[model samples]
Target: MKDTGLVAMTEFLRHPSMVGSAFPATARMVRHMLAPIDWDNVRTAVEYGPGSGRFTFAMLARMRPDARLLAIETGAEFVEKLRASSDDPRLIVAHGSAEDVGRHLTENSLGYADVILSGLPFSTLKQEDAETIMRVTGSALAPSGIFAAYQMRTAVLSLINRQFVDVRQGYEWWNIPPCHLYWASKLRGEGSYEDQIGGSASA
Candidate 1:
């Protein structure tokens, strides 16, 4: 078996835009990102850009036996590695962009996801692509579902707020570059996001 760390670093060096990070997320970072989720009742979850399946495996460990996790990866190497690494029946690895997440869910016979987690670098993505993803992600969740993402920067915060009415932010300082967490839910609203949540985020 290949060292997952080496594989992740290799991919990140080769495709920095797609892979985002040169290292896997730290245990504390993962816990901080997923701590608020109620894994027992989440029947369906979607993960974006699961480069090394680190968070994927963590979610699988906490999720119910019958729950399903749809992993959408743009990197071919990551997709292949994830499929090769997991024998768990609950994992469904899809090689594609997260823009097609809605279709992926429908194709998999899932109505809506209870948990949508992303590790994609939205700051590196095209402006239109990032906007589309945040918009679709909000619509793809179940009413009470949570959408969480962690980034080295807070550039995606405004984009997330544009889609989700209620958004919460957190920070984990132990990671390599440090990690900024955002947990967003509820749908669109008409107020100013900056006015509702006043703060500055920098990393």
Candidate 2:
């Protein structure tokens, strides 16, 4: 996570499921996961569980200057690192769960995110916690916006499908365990979102 090389043993020990070749992700996986975003049109972007900011910094590089980035991280170390690592004004690092993405957006004066990327280890997350994060993601994404995530397991695919209509997948074999990637686009009014996700659109 520190570089494009193997992640630190300490991090892998704490985040047991984040290991894939003892490396969180390479630049290859990062590029593949973030390929669908519309950089020109994006006004707000978000990232979930950005351990050492692999994809987070990449998004900052390509996004429009006026765009804002809200990074929701649960790890206190990562939260501090991301905040101290950037003075880009556009970046806002929040030390909290992805379930509160709505509040993060509102507090930052951001509408629905034009795109969101996640590196959370869903394979290790509690069922209720994972469900809450995905449901919140659906409500936080703009119509036609992208929600992308990379995982080492297939379990997250079904969860992501329930929220987005158009789903696409990729595989990054550059790592040992092989990362499974998914990016989905939310529909205009994603199927009675109030009933399914229990939130009104902020955009």
Candidate 3:
């Protein structure tokens, strides 16, 4: 909420190498994809590529007092800003690549998370790196866990859908550039358990 934080966020969003870091998504989009978070089962959440804590704030709002949030970001400046302004005791801001999420969690004793919320630039990632990220993410999920990420189009999602059994689509046309959210959950018996948490079937 500081001026420096806002300025830093703006700079990051405008950077050319990070153009895909469009920083899109309205409050409505945040509410939509993140609303059904199972706070009861979600003892810990691992958020990748949280540039300026937009979705991080939403997650904080929904988490129980005892629950912890681990934010993994590659940018040192962004990580510094987050660690400084993010005063909540439940929040842990780590400076690192999204690909290292598993190691980071393992080092912190948070090996498996109930949910993984990502803001990584899938459209910008190299094909091999993207696949690795997907594989790693899929491997880090708990049996009842869910992975939710937003992309501007379905074209960017083809590789991602290959990993999860139940790949559901959700959208929020209100955001700038709009966005299609991909929700993936580990296969339990048959279908996604999102419905049990009041989540809408991918729309």
Candidate 4:
């Protein structure tokens, strides 16, 4: 397990575009991002760009016994490492792009995810690719589900806000270079922002 950190750094050096950071996410950062998840009702969870399983372990620890986790990683080395080290039957490490999240869910017999966590570096991704991934993430989550991403810049947040109806921001200074986290949920029957604000003003 000790060498896993070194492995993560090496992967990042080789493929900076795929890996989010030079170091694995700190425990504090992982906890902050996962704080809102209702494990009891989370039937399916998806992790995008899970390099070396930093948050994967955290998610597994909090997940229900019957729930399933699909870890979608594009790097072959990371995918191989996850499969080799993980003993949990509920975890399925798939080697694929984050934009293909919907397809992965359907192929695995898992419907839309209850919660989606991302470690992808949107700042490094092409604009079109980032948009596609965010769009797929928005469409792949359940109506009330949340999408949480730990990013270094606000580019990803901007994309997420465009896709999801509600967006919440968080900050974690404990990480290697610190991070800004974004949590977003699609619009359900909840009234629009204008409607809510207008009603409050009238009252």
Point out where model 1 deviates above 4 Å.
187-203
RMSD of each: 5.0, 7.4, 3.1, 6.1
| Alpha carbon lDDT of each predicted model | 0.84, 0.75, 0.73, 0.83
- Estimate the lDDT of model 2: 0.75
Q: For model 1, give the RMSD to the true fold.
A: 5.0
- Model with the higher TM-score, candidate 1 or 3: 1
Itemize residue pairs with steric clashes in candidate 2.
none
Off by over 4 Å in 3: 1-19, 188-193, 196-203
Candidate 4 lDDT trough over 10 residues, lowest sum: 194-203
Better of 2 and 3 by TM-score: 3
Q: After superposition, how far is residue 113 of candidate 4 from its true place, in Å?
A: 0.6
lDDT for 132 in candidate 4 is: 94
Relative to the true structure, candidate 3 reaches a TM of: 0.85
Model 1 per-residue lDDT tens digits across residues 1-203 = 56789889888898887676999988877776776676888999999999998899999999998999999998887888999998999999999989999999999998899989999998888899999998889888898788889998888999987878778777878787798888787844321222322232220
lDDT for 101 (candidate 4): 95
C-alpha lDDT of candidate 3 relative to the true structure: 0.73
The digit string of per-residue lDDT tens for model 2 on 1-203 reads 24433333455676665422245567766666565555788889999877777778988998898999999877666677777778999899998888999999999899898888887878888899889999999999887788888888888998998988877667777655688877677763432212321111111
Q: Of the candidates shown, which would achieve the greatest lDDT relative to the real structure?
A: 1
**Which segments of candidate 2 are over 4 A away from where they belong?**
1-8, 17-22, 188-203
Model 3: clashing residue pairs? none
- When 2 and 4 are scored with TM-score, the better candidate is 4
